[model samples]
Target: MYRSEFYVFDQDKPVPVIIRNYTQDDFDELIQIQSECFPPPFSSELWWNKEQLSNHVMRFPEGAICIEVDGILAGSLTGLCVDFDPNHMEHTWEEITDHGYIKNHNPSGDTLYIVDISVRPRFRKFGLGKLIMQAMYHVVIQKKLVRLLGGGRMPGYHKVADTLTPQQYLNKVIKGDLKDPVITFLLRCGRVQIGIVENYLEDEESCNYAALMEWKNPFNRT
Candidate 1:
């Protein structure tokens, strides 16, 4: 087990727990977590379908992972180590756009994409998500990838709140709920946002925020 201060539980409270990667054998458990997290999450049957798995995110054999407490699925993430290829990413965006599925995007100097990071509702604020992200960051760095990327949304990407104004929009809206906690946490960890894609999700009206963050390893840059 990778023991660290991050994994240490608060003595005063019951810590939401369990973290590990997924195997082919974990298909069922993995599917269960997805269903709980997404609005219209992918079904286990859908995930297990051979055709879907081929095109699915986190294509690595061990890239798909889960966090569970006891026996129930808490959260899961699908990630991959890939070269920075604009053409390939654009191609993927084009194909998925045809089906109304927006691509989650972020770009770094051209190394790794921290594809997905999610924590279960009950598990939030407990530190598992950070643990997973920290782990992924190290793994990507070890591979000598230039940077890390991922996709996220602006506040109104789904539904705009009528109460908030433009100023409120930028501050409370954008900086508050509009901001992705994962991205915010990432930024706090020294990653710099390098790019943005406007109107990236909806029909040029509602905007989707695409951010790129880079963590340069001094040794690798040498």
Candidate 2:
């Protein structure tokens, strides 16, 4: 039921943009977007299925949201609540997200854990991803969560893995010497690099590694 509308420019033309909670009706477009965003070696089988998407909207409606640009499904962000401990942050994506089913979503948990965020290639230039993330930040505040956290893919790591360690690569990215597609995007969204997690995902580019990042909610009194 959460909805927000605005306009973005497309070559001097004002295009409509909408950010809202997901519903069963958006399943088809959501799946299509997943396929387009994570194609081929990214593993088609890992793409969001109807059942998992169903669990998302049903279990945590506010955390499962999508964005539309000029009426086209342009992006989405899905998350869940968890009782996070900064001292014990090691966990794989499958373990954290319940293999994308999110059956372990804890409504009383203090942290908003992002499961995934995808933006269509054509819509990336419009900063749609950031807007989607902003919506999730709103959700964290509305739900009174302490922070937002996620494991970011280092898709650009493979090209330099032979010469750099994962931590070294991440350090360089933080120091502005390197730019990773996912990590850099998250950095721009006000997320801080927490650490590197090995065996976090099945991505070849990242050598099965993921960069942990988080954004603390300033308004949370707890």
lDDT value for model 2: 0.92
The candidate 1 region of ten consecutive residues with least summed lDDT is: 98-107
Among the numbered candidates, top TM-score falls to: 2
lDDT of 2 by residue, 91-200 (tens): 99999999999999998999999999999998988999999998888888888889999999999999999999999999999999999888999999999988888999
lDDT of each: 0.49, 0.92
- lDDT tens digits, residue span 1-222, model 1: 222222335557555555666555566555555455543443343223333333233344344556666556666655554556544443232232222111322223345555455665666756666566665666566556665555443334334535644234434433555654445666566565545444344322234444445566545764
Clash numbers, per candidate: 1, 0
Clashes of 2: 0
In terms of lDDT, model 1 sits at: 0.49
Badly placed stretches (over 4 Å) of model 2 are: none
- Tell me each candidate's RMSD, in Å, in order: 6.2, 1.2
All candidates: TM-score: 0.63, 0.96
